[model samples]
Target: MHAMTLRLSPGDDLRAALDHAFRTHALSAAYVLQGIGSLSVARLRYAGRDDAAELRGDIEILTLAGTLSAQGPHLHMSIADADGRVVGGHVAPGCIVRTTAELVIAHLPGERYTREHDAATGFAELVIRAS
Candidate 1:
């Protein structure tokens, strides 16, 4: 595994930026080991929910971790609002960075990751393969 750190700037879309990195690096598989930063807006899909809950304000990203695949990123994050209330769920697009987002990503060179539909789960799930 090869590891690297990335810093995202203000107004950048967190999910998009990470996706871009995955493409730019030509990585077949990767995992977000850790992430910390702030966001002006956060779109999170809560457990058992079909849509994302939008949170707008000075938000602190408490945790960020997930896998990156050809289909995109499957990430989960915990964020704290100005009031210090914390909520966590699946990360969604349009999560705009407030100031910065620092991330540690590990690239798995020998493995390939993909998402395929799982009948039992009723959602796409990760599929691993040797590259």
Candidate 2:
């Protein structure tokens, strides 16, 4: 596993940035080790919910981690508002950076990743393959 760090500037979309990284690095699969930063706006889908909840304000990114592949990123994040109220859920696009987002990604050069439908889970899931 190879690791790399990414710094996202203000106004950047969190999810979109992850996707762009793979293309830029020519990586087929990677995983987020950890992330911390601030978000001016966050879009998250709470557990068991289908739609995303939009939170706006000075938000502190408490935690961020998940998988990244060509299919897309499957990230989960926790954030806190200025009042210290915390919320977490599936990471979604439109999570705008407030100042900067520092993220570390682990690249798997020997493996490939794809998302395929899983009948049991009723959702597409990660499938790892030999590169």
Candidate 1 per-residue C-alpha lDDT over 18-54 given as tens digits, one digit per residue, 9 for 90 to 100: 9999999999999999999999999999999989999
Task: List candidate 2 stretches off by more than 4 Å.
Answer: none
For candidate 1, list the clashing residue pairs, or say none.
Answer: none
lDDT of each: 0.98, 0.96
Q: For residues 30-83, what per-residue lDDT tens digits would candidate 2 score against the true structure?
A: 999999999999999999999999999999999999999889999999999999
Q: State residue 87's C-alpha deviation in candidate 2, in Å.
A: 0.9
lDDT of 2: 0.96
Runs off by more than 4 Å, candidate 1: none
Per-prediction TM-score: 0.99, 0.98
Listing every candidate in turn, what is its Cα RMSD in Å to the true structure after a full C-alpha superposition?
0.5, 0.6
